[model samples]
Target: MAGLWRKAPSPCIGICKRPGGICVGCGMTKADKKTFKRRRSKGERKALFRILIERLDGMGRLARWEHVYRRRCDRKDRPCPLDKL
Candidate 1:
């Protein structure tokens, strides 16, 4: 049970701009963000993260997000997947 409560990495970049109900930084919709925060399954969270990454990439904002993501991760002292981006 304790093992099921592991922390999940977020896709936030601190540049939250919800234009058209979608965030420009992480490419998640307002509803998606809400669900993401409450999600408890590691696999589900990871899948969401991957989808966000793909969305960012498709929008041509992947590089910019990567830069901000590194800073965000550093501030939180968390590991980022910048290399994977």
Candidate 2:
């Protein structure tokens, strides 16, 4: 079902921290967030999510990111992908 979509939803939680170029809310960097706007295949988006999850874990912020992400999904009336991850 994920592959059926033409564009991937962003993972931002709206809390951007410019000092480190990493979002303290969703754990995505500026570049990482920009990648979602590119013309990437669904599979590529899913792969990117995996890498993002790992990055969050490496920073010991996966739990925080997940919480924020879920809320963001709720606000956007979209399904949360954390279950898929």
Best by TM-score: 2
After superposing all C-alphas onto the true structure, candidate 2 shows an RMSD in angstroms of 2.3
Off by over 4 Å in 1: 1-9, 81-85
Q: Give the alpha carbon lDDT tens digit for every residue of 10-48 in model 1.
A: 677667898787789889987887787677765666667
Each candidate's TM vs. the true structure?
A: 0.74, 0.75
Instruction: Name the runs in model 2 displaced over 4 angstroms.
Output: 3-8, 18-21
2-75: candidate 2 lDDT, tens digit per residue: 54333335877666775576666666777777767673676777777787788779878889888877777777
lDDT of each: 0.71, 0.70
The TM-score between candidate 2 and the true structure equals 0.75
Itemize residue pairs with steric clashes in candidate 2: none
